[model samples]
Target chain A: MYQDWIWGLVGGGLIGIAAALYLLVNGRILGASGILGGLVDGTERAHSKERLAFLAGLVLVPVSVVPFYSSVDTHLTPNLAVVIFAGLLVGVGTRLANGCTSGHGVCGISRLAPRGMVATVFYLLGGGASLLLFKHVLGVI
Target chain B: MRALFAFIAGGTFGTGLVVSGMTDTTKVQGWLDIFGDWDPTLAFVLGGAVVPMFFAWRYTDGRLPRLGGKFPAPPEPKLDHNLVLGSLIFGLGWGLAGLCPGPAIASLSYGGFGGGVFLIAMIAGMLAAPPARRWLDAVAGSS
Candidate 1:
């Protein structure tokens, strides 16, 4: 248990490092929704090969984790309706804001962008409040 | 180029999710289940992210790159009603759906029924934004 937490922290550190490096090296923000969105939006900011490669990396990275991190259990799947609804909502939110958690919370905040700061504050607060609403207020949990 | 960097960034982010056991739906569900059994893995994950994030922010400040022209910094959005409304909607969706963009696509790699639906709806949501914006603008114009 302790080890899992330690590993989790290390993993997160790796993510932050990669995000920084990506900005430094590729000059692109690491927002998952934006990357996925640009693929179909006909943005011309990215070509088909680039889109495919980006999406492929997302899929491939986790696939590679099966060997070392077999301890993970993925059984608690949400209902189809819930999954679809949630995805659509997040997709809309990402578009409206022009970035997702990674882009805003990680990259934007790092740069001290005022918008990122405000967005992240709300992001965290909203997340916490929602959890409270669902788990406590609604008694859904 | 941004394309290659996109891949590298996604790969790194995905790897982090996998290693942290965040790609597992069961794990996320467990953490969200506060009453049944308090799982603190989420805190650990946030903590992990914050530490390196601090250093990354410090070191990268006032830095420039030779190859990448310039950092593709995100333009700050104007703080107004739009920002708040957008965030509230986002929170509502996140609360209702345990799957966000990153986790949703990441889970697809492992194969799950929900992952497909999530992706489909996500795309639909993305597509709807253009028309929605137009509608909002028209309403504003009329008023």
Candidate 2:
């Protein structure tokens, strides 16, 4: 069930459809960080209701399916400090960059937008470098 | 209503994350670990998602949305400090935790305490971003 490449494609197809649906009906790019950041930073008050509605689905669907999937395992690190630090960095950094995997990686890149493409490059570089330093050189992660 | 659409869309996205095995942090980390044992599962996922969206973007050309809202403007191509620096920072975090916003939220439905803690810290970081961004823009002269 897990690690099946076929499932990955199916899932990815579903994600694409979701984004397409959001765009066609809601007329907007579907970016998770942007949606949540707006609510957190108070910059999206005008569409808070809409944002909440979207988030409600994002959060609830997973919860609802938990009973069926039994439980979801993320395999995140046990080191709380590392987790906190990483979370903080993700939160701040994504907001600064204006998108994440959903926005820049999936949506923006699909459109072949220069900005999303560039952003994707930097992020990949960053991820590669971080892994080298921590996972290899330092062996911390 | 548009909210209903958002809900459905969001739900579909969540379902995709669960079904695609994206919610699994190990696979995500594996993808990021290009130096070590790399997994190509996510690449397919990305490819599959992009194909449909590519058409979806084309569908939006010179058209109005059914829900009566403006499509998000294409991002400007001009590079800026925030875009580079922030993306780097995000990448660093992503490598460290392998949890981006989508999985982070989706995980909340049946995640462990560790995931919960990460979410809280992430929220705090988000709240601090505006001021931090202002500081960054000031330091960098707004690119």
Candidate 3:
């Protein structure tokens, strides 16, 4: 149990450091949504191939990992309409916010931006509040 | 170098989500169900994530990344109405969908139906925003 926790922490930290470094060194903000969106949009610049490669890596890495992790079955599925609506809403929010939780919560807050700090608070709080609303209020489960 | 590393790191992170079972929307929904008898697994997952975060932030003393380039920062610093509105919408969607960009990408690794739909809708939503923003701006200006 302790080791798993440790692994999780280490893994999460590696992710955060990797993201910050990616931004600082590569000049790309490590927002998952932004990167994914860019890949679908396609690019035709000097390093566009590299951009595509990076996006490919994101998809492929998980493909590679499946052997070890063993996919767990999650029994519930929300209606397609609900899922689609949610995805669209998140898309709008990521665009409006200029980043997702990763951009603001991990990278942005690390830089000590006031906005990032505030955003992180809201991100967690909103998530928490929504959990309450979904499970308790709406009886989503 | 930064771009290359960003790609690699993001991929690895995505892989972690896939391996960790976070890509399962059911699990995400399960995690959110605190009142339906909390699962407590996600908390541990988050707790696990936070541990290294502390160390990483501590160790990296704002050194310029070995990659010469840096991501562009947003032009402004103020938390206007846009920020609040966006956060609300994001949270609302997250609550409703049980998935977000990171997890969706991770789900893509598995090549499942939900992942496909989620990814498509996510991109559409992203693409639609600029036009939506333009419309909103025009409406505000006219009024």
For every prediction, compared with the true complex, DockQ reads 0.53, 0.76, 0.47
Clashes of 1: 0
Instruction: Report lDDT (CA) for all predictions.
Output: 0.66, 0.86, 0.62
Give me the runs in candidate 3 sitting further than 4 Å from their true place: A1-7, A38-48, A73-78, B1-4, B19-21, B34-36, B39-63, B70-75, B135-143
Query: In DockQ, how does model 2 score against the reference complex?
Result: 0.76
Better of 2 and 3 by TM-score: 2
**Reference-based lDDT, residue B99, model 2:** 88
Model 2, A46-138: lDDT tens digits are 777778888999988766753457756788889999999999999998898899889998998999998788888988888878788779998
Q: Tell me the lDDT of candidate 3.
A: 0.62
Best by lDDT: 2
Model 2: chain B TM-score relative to the native chain B: 0.93
lDDT of 1 by residue, A78-128 (tens): 566666766677777777766766677667666677777787666555555
The C-alpha stretches of model 2 lying farther than 4 A from their native spots are A1-3, A65-68
Pick out the ten consecutive residues of candidate 2 chain B with the lowest summed lDDT.
Answer: B69-78
Per-residue CA lDDT of candidate 2, range B14-125, in tens? 9899888888877887887889987778788888889899999998899989989688888668788888998999899888888888889988866789999989988888
Query: What are the iRMS values of all candidates?
Result: 2.8, 1.5, 3.3
Clashes of 2: 0
- The superposed Cα distance between candidate 1 and the true structure at residue B50, in angstroms, equals 4.5
